[model samples]
Target: MKTTILPLAALGIALAVPGHAAAKSGDVQFKLLGTLVAPDGKITSVKKDLIGLPAGTQTKADDNVVPTVAIEYFLTDAISVETIAGVTQHDVDGRGALAGAGLVSNAKIVPATLTLKYHFGKDGGIQPYVGAGPSYYIFIDEKPGATAVALGATRQKMNDKVGAALQAGIDVPINDKGLALSVDVKRYFLRTTAHWYAGPTEVLTTRHKLDPWVISAGAAFRF
Candidate 1:
């Protein structure tokens, strides 16, 4: 009779289990992700002597796919914090008759973001959330390699940047063990001042606005 009662209690607990859900008090997650960024506009440089290029010197921005890794810690079932990092490369093209004369070089932008997110609907195996936070950008590899300048070179000066980020995502849980798949989208509003140094003879400067859209897909696990 005692053995029969113990087996019955264990069966009841199993039958009473509910749908997949996040942890109640504390959980940590790690994820690997990739993002596709679409640059909103052409690259504009504000420097002295750069405006004199041939009318056909075409300047444009490039949108490339980037991969990232992030880690998150959940304070409660409803709230979490995450940090992610990614980078992309871009090139300036020379076109028209002045194609040979304008600055054509490569540069990169690296962004690191810290986000705070709010989760919703965790009891049904589908969790959706929205988040907002701040980001830091570092510009590198600025070289005046080639173009039509008195010194046959050009240089870009970009300041370290601070900006705002917003993101939304949904997670699909696979089981009670906290394994899930996620899809997310994020946008950043960033501003920068570009300065170009063209040889000893010239300099140019311009203020530009950068609003980048990013889409990501990844897998996550809770511990």
Candidate 2:
């Protein structure tokens, strides 16, 4: 009689389990997102010229729109590891004295970030999360623009950078089929060194602080 009762109790418990519990432990999530990267930092020229030019010539980078993707593996219901990748292009121009001179240079950046996230939620409801991690950026196709060419700048190059990344976002379940809509904002503290030929004989060097905020929104799938 005890064995018959035990089996019935197990069956009832299984039937009462919520379907959203499928994302509980050891789940992997994939997201395809669109991102806007807006630069919010300054660029300063470090090497002062012999002609006694200003000590810190400043510049600003323009904002960009790009496509991004992220993959997350849940270590537990509240903890996960995520990696995000995206490619973006930006136009850099001078400020202050060189302002309105048009584009100084253009560069394509591919950034990959790995983060550990902490999420707050129960099974299938809205999940809000925060993450922090490190990001690696590869700068490619650094080319001189019209302004740079007019200033006799040639062979421009931007150094690759590694920086800290911070993120915050929420995931709202759209249906019971392991699908959710996600929105997140991330900031990166990135700095890089720039080298270019001011002329056929002169090489100009500077350091740029390219702290950018990335806002993303998209759909995610949990399995």
TM of each candidate vs. truth: 0.76, 0.85
Q: 73-127 in candidate 1: lDDT tens per residue?
A: 8888789998887777655444455454334345587887899999987364467
Model 1 scores what on Cα lDDT?
A: 0.69
Candidate 2 lDDT (Cα, 0 to 1): 0.80
Candidate 2 residue spans exceeding 4 A from truth: 1-18, 48-56, 198-202
Top-lDDT structure, candidate number: 2
What is the TM-score of candidate 1? 0.76
What lDDT score goes with residue 133 in model 2?
Answer: 96
lDDT of every model, 2 decimals: 0.69, 0.80
Q: Candidate 2's residue-wise lDDT over 1-223, tens digit each? A: 9999999878655433246553566999999999999985376546534323344456888899888999999998789999988889988876777775544456899988999999986565678899999999899898877876766666778889899999999987777778888999999999988766665554566787888999999999988
